[model samples]
Target chain A: MGPATQRVAGPAGPPPEPKGAIMALTQASGTRTEPRRPSRKGTLTALLFLAPFFVLFFAFTVFPVLYSCYLSLFKDKAAGLGLGAVQKVFVGGENYLRALTDPAYTSSFGNIAVYCLIYIPVMIVLSLSIALLLDSAAAKARGFFRLAFYLPNIVPGLIAAVIWLYLYTPEISPIVDAVKASGGTWDLSSTLAAYFSISNITVWMHTGYNVILFYAALQAVPKEVLEAATVDGAGPFRTAVAIKARMIAGAVSVATLFTVVGAMQLFAEPLLLKTKATAITSTWTPNMFIYDAAFDKHDFGYAAASALTFAVLIGVMSWAVTKLGSKADQ
Target chain B: MRKIRKTHVVVAVAGALSAALLAGCSSGTAPAAQSTRSGPVEITFSSWLKGSKQVVEAFNASHPDIKVTFKEVASSKDNYPALTNQVKAGNAPDVVTVEYPHVSEMATQGVLQDISKPAGDFVKSKFDPAAQSLVTFGGATWGVPLDAGVLEFFYREDLFTKYGIEVPKTWAEYEAAAAKVATADPAVRLGSTVVGDSALMAALSWQNGAKWGGVDGDSWKIDVNSQASMDAMKVHQDLFDKKLVWADDDPVLQKKQAAGQMLSVISGAWYGAALRSSFPDQAGKWRVAPLPAPTSAPATAFYGGSTFGISKNSTKADAGVKFIEWMTTDPAAISARIGGTSSTFPINTEANAAAAKTFDKAFFGGQDIYANAAAGLKTVPSGWTWTPGTPTTFSKLADGGAQVKAGKATLSQILDQAQDATVADLKNRGISIK
Candidate 1:
């Protein structure tokens, strides 16, 4: 996961050539040279260098993942008003069956589906359009625009949600007042309005970060191809749509993948909104359902089972996105 | 042979490193063992209530034999998870503040010490029967009640006079006043419903004689959807359906309250202090009344209250009980606690006079609010036992109330849903149900 993120972030820096061009060069050189195994001493040095990451990763990530899987198979049962000693009993497949059958847990997926349907396309289009405008020659102060766009992303998600919460509050918010002044009702207490309100927060916080990604990818578009399009009677709009957008298709797919994963893990924003929005229950999203199960109900076994189920769903979605993304790139 | 030796050396180094990491992570403060060798018995107290620090200081000053270390935690909603986690981790404090609804839940989960032997007699003598019932569950005294949050009606005196409305004395009259206020002005509401305050809803249900759940001869009886509970909730649902009351979480509720568009609030006795502090400009306009009941008999229930319980992990149970009894019963401790903005009605009858003397009644127009609260406290119905899955039951109730606000479901339906959810949860925990 760490190395994959680094690879994705690699294009954020200025490169002398396009990533595709660099890949082609590497591939050509790879056919000319014979692969050789490193010596035992070299391998030992590499292991020494990687040891810290491996240790921390296993302790923090791998161990908990495996432990939760083990815990999900057992449950704590206390008899007759639970005053006596509690006992941990192995209940194979029961926790998972209960999680699947529970309406509240299952409905949380429906809530996430609504959130993702609204969040993903809006985020992708808004960021891509802003990146295109920033890349155009007619746009002014590219550096300032990029920084201004990325400012909200730098603010932590919790802090950003809090700031947006203030704006969503009717008594204190000038936005709500302005809407009311114009004879419009801005009600966030309803379920559909809450979905839009939460999606608005995520979009505000993330569009700028993806704008930078798309902007960097747009920069790597071969200048000759764009110039050739311009010479062939193609206007800037046509050239941008036909040449630049196609070149950065890979970046768009990556952005969509991240946004989909993010939408599936929607928690902090809706959880904060739950304080004010009556429509958002404690189990508004899958993550919130798992959290309420573990902490509020003290049903760690059920929480673990639901969490593992959600993880598998996310894994399959991510894999499908990657497969389709690569096919689109081709 | 050389490759095997290298592999063995690598494995040994990794194992040693991981073991060291695990040891470092697991090293925490050891539980204080029985204080036989101590010059003074040391115990840790954790609370988030206002004036707790002052009370702890008073206890430490007066009691030389028992030394207390106080830790300020977050409010109850955020504190319970941390408290239970600490209990599970075996490093919980000696004494902690838990609410009435959570006492049974925590006691049943083995997070709290069964203090029957140490504090049972003292609790029976010092506290009233209603307060005593709140702490004693399943034949064991789990905690000592610090306050009795007797439900009360806080209304705008000037608004009621201007609107020519009488102070409601029954549920039927309250509904009439709600409709009258709506007719007088669509913008003004007689009161508001707190859709997310399951405690407030539970108190309302209790006033109507709803026994949510209780232990019945070693088995639990789950009855959240009783006739009384439905009748109590139907009134709120009717007001919500007619838009006569504002949803408490709506920002407009605050706006209306500040602008004098909202006429009343139904909450515990502590809310008088909150109102005075929150709306200082409307200080003289507010008055307190006993909560209107379904009948004229004047029944009430506790809205919000805290109790002190010793953690099961603490070995210093006696020291912890001494601290709790002092905090709840000692007049000096009660006075110190009321020296702040807190208006908690102490369950200890003897300490009420001390609390009233320090509490400034100038906020409620010099009305003897404590006397009014005491009158209401006497009317609280008993036999309302909070079962083991209170956290789940409350959240479901709150969610149902939310659905009511969203116009998605009625309160009666939500009550039935909560009843089913509670029964399912208790059954899942392997608690025998009748």
Candidate 2:
């Protein structure tokens, strides 16, 4: 969980724009390969130019991902004095089986599933509506509102979690005091309160970035199309919901995918709130589970096994999302 | 998958080249460290102890030939795992600090340098009997004894007087006192234990002479959730159910204790110093007593304790031993870490008088903490060996304990889960569990 993802999570107000990253990557690779087909010198020049990105991509992303999977297949075995020598035994699928069977590991996914169930719908509606409101006549100080709304997204995710954690703590938090002042008790220590407490953080950190996206999409909508609709007796609500939202369906799809992925990797917020929120455990989320395994438990094999599984799951989910989006377009 | 397979062939060649380069460095360092031909020997010490730097510096002052640098790692529970990773990565510190509960795991796993040939004599002669007893497993002393982590009760004297609660000398008395305190002030309780903190519970189990984890012939035995552990668990469960103790610790408990909302905290002497900084206002109101046990036996649990070990990867064994010898023997080193703040309890019997002389009684309302701590440390029952998978076991138990508190499971089920998880983890790590 980070503030940077806030700016990355959504699509706003207009018809979907062409997918930005894939277009850039394909164009970069295609143009380079298409040129210099027969000449060795030309090919060498192109290769030299593209070397940095490929080398970095392979080393940081490709190699580690592959190596991590390789590590999962072999577990470290202690012999003699616990540290005398560590033997690497190829346990194959044992780590995976253990992770799958583990209640802690399985429970993390359960937590995230419940998190997304609460987060996605509320996030989508609130951001989309906020963007539409800004686009309509009622929202004045448009520039100020845009900045003010997006500012929460700018707070680093860890810092944002910390800030909200303080706001959650009864002894130190003014928010808790406010609730008490209102004759209401907010026991964030409970399981349900802790879940919503973290969900609120994810929403707070993310909603504005999506708002900005929607607002930008709204701006991109053809003025003539909206004017024509209004001339035929369409109101602001109809223009926003019927004409505008469908136009930005691609953006909405992208945001939904990001939300799903973000929901999957939930870690920092829950971890930071763990002290005040007793229900949040060491293995509260999949990321936390991986951290506990690799760092806390020192079982790298089990950690890598679970990590690879989670990675494959995300990859499949993203692909399915893209496939579904394309079919919707057709 | 096929494409990545093809890429792996090319990557394999690159990996071999890197491996060769790494081997080159390792071989070079080994020979250089083999002889006294080199200048002053240097070794790295990794510990999370608060004043480890001062202790190391004191060692450096005494032994000019051995220049030791300190690398501060995480707290006790996290330190071993991090050190294990470092050792596996082949970039380990020459000297590593392991805690009481993890000593056997480290010792038997063969991760440490066998100093028997060189430093064993020094350890047998100089180390504290208890600390020495802890590190000796499977026929060798794996590390140097550092300090005592004996448990003690730090209670608010003023609160006890106000509530008219008697000083509890037994578990039953402790419960009665808790009940009295809770009735006197509904806002505060006598104490609170973190539901997820299996470390505290394990230590308490140790007081009952529970062999929760230990080596069994050629295999490891994970006997948590046994009669002894269940005995300790019963006390904690009673505390939780009766609303006599909180399910939290300092910072969270700090505010309550500072405001007299929480009356006492029964933990190791190391935590006593923490009280001064966290709640300086509560001074002169608090006092220290030996932790209560069943039947007034004066038995105490060891908590948050550590020992110093030399890594097998270190070629400088003699230098490492010399440094450890000085740290354990020198009153100056122990004195540098004197008081509860720096984690000093004079595990070295010789340093007791000096440590007691430098002891700061101001924090504990003039209570002779060192004297009482010595008495408590004297009563720690032996045979409380640790398994390498203590952290693994505790993490599960911690989560399981939370589940129990949440009404998702029962305490017995959680302990059983801890036992099963410990066994599975030990097996995974190649610790025989048959």
Candidate 3:
């Protein structure tokens, strides 16, 4: 049955009329009723709108992770000059211990942690400040600025890496020569240089995107509040700080979280730069290291172990981001 | 307001149910296609051919009784694990391409069918012995010697003529000639070797009588830290010290080699095809000659090549053998694949001769590369084998060599460390070290 019918069936339907007025008789017809239970039809319509997103989320995100976790427990074994029998041994927790104790794995983790510490705060502040300027300005060509900022994200990651690789290369790179000409040596092949160079590429590529987001959020803030603040004694800077800026703490928190996750999973930059940089070992990043161990070294058990450890680390960090960012948003 | 509240309750319940159903549907997508087909006599053939579809189509056309399919694997490193997993799961390809350096690695993995007796009748006389020996490890013949990657010097005749210099017949003369060419124009240098390619290094070292590992009776002993290898390392050190070679690692070095930026290149027989294909305009300006010897001995060794092996998990193991036997043992298949394409020298002796007859001598400035490569193929010695752990060991050695090259460590110190590391790595991998 429809929700409207169910509500009318409840007790205490009509109110008492005032005696003297005939016009009051129409007012006495007012009904009192209880809330109706939701109908099945309404629930069905709501579900129809939500189906697509949940389908993708479970397929791509959930299943493979569980499968990999299962595979991580078994070790592949070959017997007798590798020309005899082969077997899979299930050794509980052994693979994880081996991965944890591996120097390559530990070193890669340490490298990523240091990278995150340097990159996250710098990216967050720079992007936030640029976003604020772009938001606060009375620029006429807002769309042009938005497009200019988002252009880097459109460039394929591999292509960007290849272009940056050449620019960083000292052999044909005029940029390197320019640096040297000014009494500075810019070698992107060293440990410190590789980190800085990769960070620069990340900042150049992503800062524009963050700017677009911050501007969008700023535009959503109520204009009257900012106008009132400005009408009082507040200047543009003070108005932004007192009213509009406080409105984008949520956006800032979200951007900071994204930067943290991206920094931890740094792969393409390090991978492309590996041949150029002597210091960038094959295992310079955890993902690359796991890949090398599995494919290059042909040690799947070890690779799976390392990958699971990496996943766990990323999981913890991602959880922390969501928790802290959402709490701060509230 | 009551009706609205009732609708909200109804909507939320429906929403939750659909979410659960959608999640259920999505969770099973990747795992849905789990079982292999049951009806047809299906066989998969793993190959590294750039245009493998054409080959597979051609094979399928002649043999409709058995259906054959093919897949292109990324590279040896990427292919091995998947291949191993498939084999372990009882779903391996019938035929798999086993590159020369990896034949021993694969053979040791116990996923290769031993065709020793069937392969025994194949003539050692017609093939590059070194190429054949790499596949015949641990008293079992695991592959058919598909082709030989014998090294030869590809020199620019125009540059030689411009400098009024002759192609050097020995290492000392080659150096002298390189010095002369450099003197003629400081803009150009000698040659470039992939210093990072340990296989290339091992080949050169083997030509200089360097041994890696050997089986004595029932025991295997690794000899990576031998005197001959150390002596061979000196040649590379000398080249780097003199700045006679380029340091940047890329295929552009090969392009530079073509452009006469380098006078000569020490590369495999397949290098000829690359010259003809990549630099088609500079065809007649280039000539191939046999590598110059450092010593008085007339011997050489293999640098690289691909071989074919049968997967142990294949239900069509016999059919796979028959196919590889036809490709490797039959003269027509090898001749057409190698000689007709003018790609590499076929391992089949008759096929090599046929291929040699088809080669254009004008590309080499009238030097018959076929005749030269054929001669080099004979003098090539054979004493190398792959263990499952070689890739790891080689990568480690390369890193060690890089350290030595960078002056971070002395050669002796690096070698000692590499030796210890290799032994430990092999032991850990469960390879018997004697």
lDDT of each: 0.85, 0.76, 0.69
Q: Give per-residue CA lDDT, model 1, range B1-434, as digits (tens).
A: 88778778788888898888787557445445668775889999999998999999999999999999999997877778888788877788999999999998888777898999999899888887878778887898999999988999999989999999999999889999999999999888999975557788789999999888877889988888899988898788777788878875656677789999999999888887788788889978888999989898998999989999999889999989999988998899998898857788987888887888778887778888899899988898887888887888888988877777777888788878888888888898998899
Top model by TM-score, which number?
1
Residue A83, candidate 2: how far off, in angstroms?
Answer: 6.3
lDDT of 3: 0.69
Chain A TM-score for each of the predictions: 0.88, 0.87, 0.79
Q: Which residue runs does candidate 3 get wrong by more than 4 Å? A: A1-67, A166-188, A220-250, B1-43, B50-70, B73-78, B88-90, B123-126, B164-166, B169-184, B216-220, B251-255, B339-341, B397-421
lDDT tens per residue, model 2, B1-434: 75456457545755775576567536524433443666778888888888888888777777778889888876765676666656655667888887777776665444577777777777788765656666776667788877777888888889889888877888889888888878877888988864667777887888878878666566666798898888777867777777788765345666787778887787887776777777777778889898988766889877867678788678787888888777776777778766346536757777666677776778777888888888988888876777777776777777777676666776667888888888777776776775
Which ranking of candidates, highest DockQ first?
Answer: 1, 2, 3
Q: In terms of TM-score, how similar is model 2 to the real structure?
A: 0.89
- Stretches off by above 4 angstroms in model 2 are A1-38, A78-84, A101-103, A189-191, A328-330, B1-38, B74-78, B107-111, B339-343, B407-410
Local accuracy of candidate 3 as per-residue lDDT tens digits, B1-434: 76677668666765786677676545523222222455435667887644345545655665655567787888765677777666656666788987777776777665688877656556344456666567776777888876778888888888888888888777677667767767778767767644556677777767777767666544456677688777766666666566666655564465566567877778888778777777778877888777877676666677677777788765566656666665664555544455444566777776676667766666667777877788898878666665556676577656655554455654445545556766666565566678
lDDT, candidate 1, A112-188, per-residue tens: 99988998899889998999999997999999999999898878777878888889888788998999999998777
Worst window of 10 by summed lDDT in candidate 3 chain A: A1-10
DockQ of each candidate, alpha-carbon based: 0.57, 0.33, 0.17
